[model samples]
Target: MILNDFLPVNKADLLKLEWDYLDFILVSGDAYVDHPSFGPVVIARVLLDAGYRVGIIAQPDWNDPNSIDILGEPRLGFLVSAGNMDSMVNHYYVSRRHRETDNYSEGGAMGKRPDRATLVYTNLIRKKYKDKPIILGGIEASLRRFAHYDYWDDSVRRSILFDSAADLLIYGMGENQVVEIAEYLNNGIEVQYIQHIPGTCYLTKSLENLDQYIEIPSFESVKNDKIQYAQAFKVQYDEQDPIRGKTIVQRHSETYLVQNPPTMPLERARLDWVFKLGYMRNYHPMYEAGGGIPAIKEVKMGIISERGCFGNCSFCALAFHQGRIITSRSHESIIEEAKMIQMDVDYKGYINDVGGPTANFRHPACKKQLKVGTCKHRQCLHPEPCEHLDTDHSDYVELLKKLRHLEGIKKVFIRSGIRYDYLMHDQEDAFFYDLCQYHVSGQLKVAPEHIDETVLDYMGKPSGKLYGQFVKKFDQINKELQKEQYIIPYLMSSHPGSTIHSAIKLAEYLRDINYTPEQVQDFYPTPGTMSTCMYYTEIDPRTMKPVFVPKSNKEKAMQRALLQYKNPRNYDLVYEALILAGRQDLIGFHVKALIKPRTNVPKAGGSKKSKSSKRKTPSSKTSINSIEKTKKRR
Candidate 1:
């Protein structure tokens, strides 16, 4: 595919196609990369396949209105997105420091897109064409369709609809919503009258009585009180199902934000058609001068066989953004994509990844999920796997088996993530045995998050015992297969429920395992997540119970340092944290001690305590058992 083959970005390309005006113009924060992994490209291609003239304006200059005028106005409307990721998250780190590089931008440079790209771009477009129908989609808009807690501002903000002033907001996977909105506009219907489309949110002046709709707390109430915000979030969370979900309404002063029920998840055939949309599968040549996008490298050969996740970790936004209902393509569809991947000029024997949010999740959690939608208040795999939960991985196992045997494919690895708790629930171990025997490339990565049960409870994760059982089972299976694969468990520090004591306990657990993680994730409170709500409101929305949150930088640093207590640089923080937690016994020169006693003289006003005469030898089993007992008691 040449440059002209791509959707026109400027007047010259439009002239080549002999089109005076486009049906729709897409404005994205990311550089144009016509790949399925990129949301903007997928929406554009879907529109184009529907026989609409779609043009793109990627990373337009927010500083100048003329930059948005390059594509002029579309006959249908404007589709605005903050690229594949939330703009604030893409541009800044948890520490509120500007990121040095943006993988979404050309050459991995910074500042190609502005902060709050959707809001900024929409305002710019409105400045030029005041009456054009502007629609917001992508992660930023999808997750913030309701009133949300904005980490950058440290305050609760109103819905994106009020702020962006866009006619409609398409949340979740927008393939279904975008098409419906386009067709409505194409039929000469005004954007204001197209409010009833599923998966789309629109502003309204009056509340209409609809039996199928539920009303959440008004924005004024949430803004004035955090408790109201949490309550509102719970109501919104309960109505996300496509099969049985109801339209949600929340008042913002005189106007209202009415979110229609989510669009039904695409079936196998529709999903296959979307993936086979003849994507160029590469960055546009326009980026050749600035070096092609680096983000493309990670996903160029990866296959997203499924969409959505049922492993709804509280910290994750997938449930709210992608919905909990899992939808997957057929094996034939995936195999065909993999065959195309093999023919790529840069194709290697290895396929990067073969999964979605949760790689092993091929279908809904259970048979009932398809009929009744997901259980609103209950979870499928947390606490313990529900009896109705489906744990079969035969389909996934067969899919992987076929991929590995495909010509020119040496190894097909599952790099996305595996829900260990879900994997452990499988009674028959065919998938487990196969994963250990074939799929694992030496180490299988998993997210245990933390070792403390109290912290795990607040995280909506299973108990530490489940993770322990999984670790033992993984080792047992590996041993049975005569394989030497290791488990690289992902750990998080300074999460909402984590205190100094919890951090110290986690550190001690790491000491017993004789492993210090090279990387530790400091809890990031992004918008539209239960964890973020807790970080802001200091209350669990599900139970409305107060939660202990680690908010201070010093406290957070201590927790993060404890995860890497083995490092010499972290010795002081580790010792300080231990003392603060009343675990100073873990600071002496002994096998059980997390850190050795300071040899240097004490600083001013600092007192030293005498060392214990008797010290018990460190035993991994004893330490692990003690932690487990503590969890049980809690």
Candidate 2:
């Protein structure tokens, strides 16, 4: 239980370790928490286990030049990252307003790190030590390796390596890539010669020997034309697999940006070894007086049983970052971690979660994924399950059963999102029944995203009819078990293809179900997602088809208000949206009406209105059959 067992973060710690020089100095935007959930910690631990000396510098002052000099220079090079999240997304909201809290910081404080953190940190290091090699890895660097649209600046920018002046950019999960790069560097190989490694991006004077690689549109073309940008993103999206993926190259003004194929997925033993490292499982003791790090609470008791995802939602970045191949830990590895949790002094007989990107996904999508990789043009679960998809849940079910029966463990909940579409694909009912009986804590959260068929199609999700069938099956199982469990759905507003009419349709559906969501999430256009491309260019990247995007603040607000029309504050916006959508007939006082008409009341000096002031309404039927079908859930 020694607190000093964590990575060296200061000069004193380096002195204690008796190391005169280190191989790599890792810089991160988040406060150092030596848990597997944090990206910097995982990469640092992997490098450390490879017999290389590593030190860390977290959240250094960007205004002062001497802030990054605490840890002297490393022997080989420096590793730079912007922590678990992208710096811009961590600092600002969709409205371009600064956020009040930073979840990855101590005490939930803000202003810890600067914007474009990878660029800032790399430049800072370059200012002090101009000749040293600097390598960038993490979400901020991986997604920005190509010329991407900058939401904050409202313009397309060149590759981050050009701005940051870093030697190499390691994309995706960089366990194998980092080790290979380190081994090459340690053996006296220069950074210029390290471009041939897989999962690394670098700038070249020409595409001389890369005729076999797939050439994308140049940066200048995409920066000027929105249609070309969509085409470029489509080419990038289709070639992310490790097996059949080809090396991709894009041209800038004078240089070419070459991105090698993704690194191979981790095998069972390698995945287990990475998680079994000596993680402190909490924030460093120096931050204990500041109430510790808030981000650690999310995974302190939760076990990441797997990695990668096959459910490629259009709005999610997992496909680009973690890839669409699923890799998991052995059951013995998971049980060993759970046993460690049972020994905690604060153990309350509860395990928060036992899943990764998607909880139920334990292995690759199918047998062919191991050899040929995932399909380049189609997704495994989107639109419909592939004919070759292996949808067995037996391994997950057996693992959960063993965890719940442990001596000191009490309730085990699956808080991570479960893919209901995949669950329904399974022919057996054992996993579904056991999930309802054991894993649920009164409510199970799922994401159907939207009910409109057009919007669902744009979202890369199944139709609403599939969700209806799943809901019916869930209710039937709960009834048989005599439990009062509920399924709370996560819905989104103002996604691509969702027009004013579509918003009104969602509002009417909510009214019929007699349910209201407390909060609604507006679709955020983060980098490296198919949906974000549509949001910025008004065209789908996959098919280059025109899409309806809600970009104005007023339009986005009105769409969000329609989801929560029951709130008195949203009455005006909802009323206006209904009128604009040609649904003014739903303004009267009736069971099918969405809102009441705006009427003037008597002021201090005015007279009261008569009963005739209320508008007369006629009985109407609004999707009564759909309402009856959904009555069991209520």
Candidate 3:
């Protein structure tokens, strides 16, 4: 493959192809990494396979209108996306501080794309092509399609379609929606009139004759009344399925934002086909000097074995974007991708990852999901596993064995979450044995966000007892295999239901395990999550009961400090937190004490894990059920 093989990024390449006009120009926030893992590249490839001429404008100078003119105007339209991640999340930390680097940009540099990139890129396009159709897709637009709270702004905002002035917004995976859109636009249908497509949101003046849609609440009501906001989010959250979902309407001022039900996910064979599209599978060569795109390092060798997630954690946005249904590529498709990895000049004899949202989930949670759809208000493995839930991982085990046996493949690692709760539910141990024996590198990472029952209930994770059971089994398996491996449970601090007491309990558990977390993720209330609804409304939409949200920055800081109480710098805040919670008993010199007393008061000596302690994980019945965001995978 040569430079021309990749889609044209500039007019010179278009000239080299001897093309005078283009069909669609994809403008994205992320630096172009032409691989299936990137949404923009996948959409562009899908369109190209459908025989449309496509060009990409990646990380163009947003301030310069002429910068986007490099590709000129396309005959069909322009596709605008915030790339794989939400732009604001890409640019800032949860604390609202500017991030030092942009993983998606070349050299991990910040400012490659502006904040709220889809809106900015659309505006840039409008400056020159006033009448051209501009369509929005990707995580940013998908999650922000309806009127919702904005974390960085700390206020409710209108739908992105209303604010960005784009012609239409594709809310979910756009392979099906974009092709339908391309066909309509190619047939000379106006963008404003292309309102009937599933998974597309549009602005309307009247609801006349639109009797099949559900009107949750007006933007003004949701913005002014917190209760209304929670109720609206609940409706939006409930109707995400393609089978049972209805058209959703939320009015903003005089106009209405109408989101059609999500498009059905691609069948397994078609999903397999989409991955085999001719992709360069690397960042553009022009970025080589700047160390290529840092984001690609984790994904370049990994294969997206599946899409969609049934393990819907409350804080995760997958249920909103990918929906609750699960879909996967065939073993043949994945094995083919691994062969490509073997051919790469950068191959290091290891497959970085072979997983998706939940690696072990290769199909729908149950056979009923294939026919009717996912139940709106229920989860598969949280609270308790449903009787209908499928726990077989034999197919996954077979797939992994085939991958390990491939030529030039030294080891195949399962990096994308393993869903240990789901694994524990299985009666057979083939997958569990294989996961420990073949997949694990040095350490296996799992997310048990918090151990407090109250917090775990709010988080929709399995019981703490379940996590303890998983840890025991993991240790036993490693022992049986005679390998030294560790389980690093991803921990969270200051979530909606967590209190100072809860934080202390989590800290005590860490102390018992003799583990010091190198990094902790504070709760970030981004849009499209039930947790964010609780954060803003202080009420659980499901039961409409009062939820205790740790909103004050001071309390949030103290909770975070409690998670890392062993650090010398956190002594002050941890001391204050302990006193406020009336738990100063934990500050003494006993081995069970969390921190040392101040002023050289014969301070509590740091304790080591006894041999028996090393044999087990923290004993909080549900302490290590981490609800990891898996932010890097998408």
Candidate 4:
């Protein structure tokens, strides 16, 4: 028999395929939700733009190998970035709910975005083409480049490279680094030499190279111990150094690896691999199966009119992550995307959302110092509008009118959530009139986190009156047009500046307006964000000072429960909140009649696994005997 007869059937076929016929395929596991991500699409776009033949495998089932055949098998090494979005965060409700339970280590975790799909694809690639390279990137691979303190699991885990068996791990934005890898391989370089590329973390066989690697020093405190991990995790950026480097676990015991200060922002590329033409497939399953909101129902397929945001809500990370400079897509591209959506078999006469982080805030309201050669680091509203700033809404007005005229599109909706503060401007008022008349289907979501000035200030909101005036104007416009859409204002509770008193005021406002919001968001601190850093570190890295932190759990829970006070069971929470806030007058209301003993145990952490120290997850004892025992204890 020939030597080929010794090989497995599938492997024998792959071994005989000509390398010249192979296409450079980049598969993204990220859900194509129109947001920039750290998945395969970003890299795929780059390779495609560079003239390399590339195809994407989005949200593929990693468990199934047949999915790999969609790209037609002529394959270069696989680009296996897990997902563009964090898998854990996707499973969360509003992000503030708890995640762990005694039966499982990390329940409620929206684990593995398109990345799991990528991992599966990569494994299949290896199964066929034995020596082919498989690279992993994105948040899951990046943050856990080394041993990390997983709070929910309450243990230190091995690197994802070890777990996924990927040949390489491209940690940060895999832009320049990925390009270098492609070029190196094309030029006949081995994978070993390509590991030298910066912005990546990989394993080496020699221990001698350990000292040359970055060190975290503090990582030893938390390994094998969850509480120490939580404490160590709480440490903030060392302001003494300008770089703001990340702390990592070292290769050896009792040592930590601290990376150099964070690198400068990667210049925005013409196309990002994280976002592709059709990446939404990645999120379809989880979102369909998700709690409360469904992506199928929420997203109706529309083009993004703009990129980035300007609203600097302190609690929000959009401004920092996406940037404050607003970039509207050329009207031609948007119209083309709209035309494509009309051709979809699933077209439901409604275009889901068609705006950036904030729909109508189309242009940069303020002229930033970055545009000019010099820097004038001052607020736009501080004194008067600066010389370079043009606070105008004329362009957006024209664009809206043009879109309305498009044919075959049943209804165009603006549901990205609007910044009411910006909408209250002079030119913007007329625009709002048109928006209320045409854009809004029935409900317009506006975030008014809290009524208290202090809380609003903390959230970087303009004013309570701004929202009130907009609502009144919206109503007036609806009356004139003889339509029936209403503003659905989003409210948040237990934010940083919130108190029991402020919560009562918010509840009272809801009562007065007779507006019980369909959703109430509670503040959650995510890792590597400014708000989380503030909450955990208690010091502003910019100012080098401490900030106030309300350390009362009772106060926090009461504030959160106040918004849901209509239920008789919530009376205990609402009554206590009012009394704590020194508004005892509210105690005599229907809130007093529903006082009952608390049955549910208080849950902590988030739907995402907490990278904290070992903490026992609460057991859900539903058995009748267990219930009776629990009831007796209560």
Candidate 5:
């Protein structure tokens, strides 16, 4: 409510706060939202708590070099981040089309920031203050800190530090590294010499005496050879732990890129302190008259109870950015944050979410993970749950119980992704029962991704039969509780190994259930995901086997259309997809059919005849069971 509640955004703010120069100036690609959900704000607050002056420059004009001159040069250096979401991912879609509206900007406007925002902002800062240390962090720099694939360029590019010529690149949750770097810089250590820190990457002219570091294929080799690129990705993926991980180096042209091992995750108390460090918990007032940031509406009432995830789905970037080891906050911390929500004007007695990357995972998958790090060759939840895998949800259930009974809170929800396979793996059903009773807001969304065995294998997802079992259990619980809640399964269309036949199979599953997903996810080959590596190499890095990548836009469209077969608008594409897959058997009037015959197509909106979609419907549970039974019989 006051001008000083948020960090200083411009010269006027610095003047109002009576500051002459900032100790650290953070350049971001998002609207200035002083909330804990935004990474830039967290880093800034951490720096401020360390007794340093910090200011922010959000969405600066690329054309006007003076736009960054408002905050003036910092005494320590300038910090660069591409906002919470990657800028390129924010600006364009999987189809490479520009998104019409920006959720992180004022008025939901697009083009307020440029593509590859970290590089742009770093270059802008360098233009004003040459030789000043430029530190790169956030998802953009974190994922692309090494030689990796760029979907927009369709080629492997050098590290952001290499391309931007920045001094340091801090990856992962950067609270630990940011404060360390600040103290070192405060003591007058050169940024170039600050290379030994973990969870960071830097460039060097020599790799001598660094025998502890593992050397991977160089930029030239990976860019030209797909196999080598896959190998490099595997090394990076396996060696991301702070405990067991070693330093990794890759050569680019003449210089070498060194990525120090990941920083140790914050303990419960540190995570609690980070979240409780006086966040405004809202977007800046400058945007209130301009419709405000749409992204804040989703997380303003939400609480991040944990960090990291062991559900290492290959398509997800969490493993690369947040690692697989789980770190969580304590009950008191989360409950206090929940009370903070009551102070919001928009609080309606509902807590939007209370989980992080994966909702139910509160601790490491096993006892050994915290000490020795994750196994290099095996995953906790892939192929099969590890023998030491722990599936206890008592902590999370208790947290929600305390929150549900809070004075002003009416309902507490877990909107974050729930690993159904992990949840069902539990021996007891207490958390499942609690989840259904307290968390179900008419529907629970889970990501089974795809049902086809081969695609699921490539995606590192559990077998569809497991999802079916989970679904059955979900239905039984909701029914027993007398709640009319439905399971909204998040389905994906084209992934690395998903062929038209595979897509047709998923469409058939949807047909069998008589349910259609409201939205479809196409596999996006972002910079730092194993699936993206597979997408580029056409080979699964884990097995070194060939994968069928659906790259054609038309084929992807057809696959997407198959998911919405009931819509008359998708008839043509769905018809073509089924025909191409030699699935004419699924194009007829049978109850198992995915689409109507070509002759039965309506002229516009939808169907008109009694033979249309308004026909008799079957029980969704029975239909899903039938699907599993058919798969088993086949």
Candidate 6:
């Protein structure tokens, strides 16, 4: 049975009943959204498919101990995870600025700290069942696998494995590693035995046994003495000695046991858990709270037909977490899900997103090239596009056509943002025409982060010319179809390579297109992500060196405010921004003239004292009038 099967029971009452029943209960700190995060949901589904009973606790309040009992009870099984999406309240919205420094966004520190939350959650479980396994995954646990700087606390913290009291901390992708852990536990293998498992971290009372093994130095040690770790890690995976993997020694009490490359899961196996619909509950609950229609409540809904894309945009984390290789679902499974959504009464008449990462890019381009063992290119986003890489639109066209003919489905839409550059590669332009004539709800979203070629190059995005070409083609199609649909472009500002000059160029592009977009985003750096590290430290983790750093606050605010040029308040910000950019020549021009210049005049001392503070002198006439009134009363 799936997790939603227990919804009929009262959550408070359910907490009071069972103390020790569930084989494994997974708790998530993040609101269980269908976004790639429901990794625990995926992991739980996989375990259930393997014939083990599993349950999930989504968005449990760590501050409330009662929420822990909702999982029923912990038993002899594994607790898997990726940590909470937001470590604290401040992390959720970038709009909130720090009190002291009008510059930095407030660091995430409002909710219960992860280690403390885990401690409280684990103690509740231990009271019911002693020594059950608890393991942590996700970006938080993975990046914090070793000692690292804590910007919130302003100090280095201990390893999360030691702090959270988890049996093990799985680092990278957990598909293969999680199963290995479960099988070992089922055979009555002690948690200690799995310490050597690759892509995982475990704790022991002493480091005696691991001394013989290859040691990977902590990030702190590398930061203090870069020469040692850089040289060690620079050795290519193949060139390194077999016995001694790329192990960097640093001067610290802790060390890392660097493993070889990670193991990837099969496409078929990953898709199996997805069709079971474990994440449906997670996604629905949030939409209900937010006063929006959940996917299940809608007339029609669909899951991604695939995982991962090879676009490798610098600002995207999907490529990092999901990997560059494309993993697709069988065509039959996707059609079946569409049919199921159509059957639901809530189905309004729309089929939501039916595609994955880069919706239209279907098959892996590198599969054939890799088989020949002659692949020389590291990335497909380079200047010279791969000749073998098939930028084909046939598969997407076929999928959309098939989806449109499904029973009882009225409108099939492509809601997920599409890569316009890739869409431009449609050989016959049939898909573009079909999309304009049939799909889309009057607007198609596309991401063109900036118009500057240099910034575009650094971001690994298509040239500005590519977006323009797609727009022109799309416009022609719309005119032919007599449709009033427009393009809703998604733009990112203050990315690592973007500067004030680049932002101005983007603003000019927006103005030229006569597009006033409300959907503008400032880049957010999440843990373990390449962009996040580059944003914070200005150092690339792969290279262990510095890169071009941009002034985050001023540049970010300017970018975000560009979409609101017509607003009067934006004029104040725009003027101040121009002054900061040293482009004072542009000040008091255009809309900026409406904003009054700031004044620094001091307040008068007389006005500072209020009227009530100055006592009034009572006249003799007032005293006589008071006496007469007293006499009349007597």
Per-model root-mean-square deviation over C-alphas = 5.2, 5.6, 7.1, 11.4, 6.1, 13.7
lDDT by residue for model 1 over 1-634, one digit each (tens)?
A: 1222688999999899899999999999999998999999999999998888999999999998899989877999999999999999999989899999999999999999999999999999999999999999999999999988899999888999899989999999999889988998999999999978889999988775455678888988988898999998888887889988888999899988999999888888999898988888899999999899999999998999999888889999999888898999999999999998988999978898899999999988999988889998788887778889999999999999999999889988888999988888888899888888877899999999998998998888878888899999999988887889999989999888887789988998999989989999999999888899899898889899887777867678778999999899887667666765568799888898999876565556767533432332323343334334434445
lDDT of 3 by residue, 231-341 (tens): 899999999999999999999999999999999999999999888888889899989999989988889889999989988788999999999889999999999999999
Per-residue C-alpha lDDT of model 5 across residues 471-528, encoded as one tens digit per residue? 9999999899998899999988889877767788888898788898889988899999
What Cα-based lDDT does every candidate model obtain? 0.88, 0.88, 0.88, 0.54, 0.88, 0.57
Clash count, candidate 3: 11
Across 95-168, the per-residue lDDT of candidate 2 in tens digits comes to: 78899999899888998899999999999999999989999999999989888888788888999989999999
lDDT string, candidate 4, 593-623, tens digits: 2233334343465444433223332232222
Better of 3 and 4 by TM-score: 3
C-alpha displacement of 58 in model 4, angstroms? 6.2
**Model 2 Cα RMSD, 1 decimal:** 5.6
RMSD of 5: 6.1
Candidate 2 vs candidate 3: the lDDT winner is 3
What TM-score does model 3 achieve against the real structure?
Answer: 0.94
**Candidate 4 segments exceeding 4 Å error:** 1-78, 92-136, 139-181, 188-297, 361-389, 425-428, 479-482, 540-555, 589-634
Positional deviation of 323 in candidate 3, in angstroms?
A: 0.7
What lDDT is reached at residue 196 by model 6?
A: 62
Judged by whole-model lDDT over C-alpha atoms, candidate 5 comes out at 0.88
lDDT of 6 by residue, 42-65 (tens): 666666556556666654555666
- Candidate 3 has an lDDT of 0.88
Q: C-alpha displacement of 47 in model 1, angstroms?
A: 0.6
Which ranges in model 1 have alpha carbons more than 4 Å from their true place? 1-4, 209-212, 601-634
lDDT of 4: 0.54
Model 1: how far is 382 from its true place, Å?
1.3
Q: What value does the lDDT take at residue 380 in candidate 4?
A: 37
Instruction: Quote each prediction's TM-score.
Output: 0.94, 0.94, 0.94, 0.66, 0.94, 0.75
TM accuracy, model 6: 0.75
The window of 10 residues in a row where model 4 has the poorest summed lDDT is 1-10
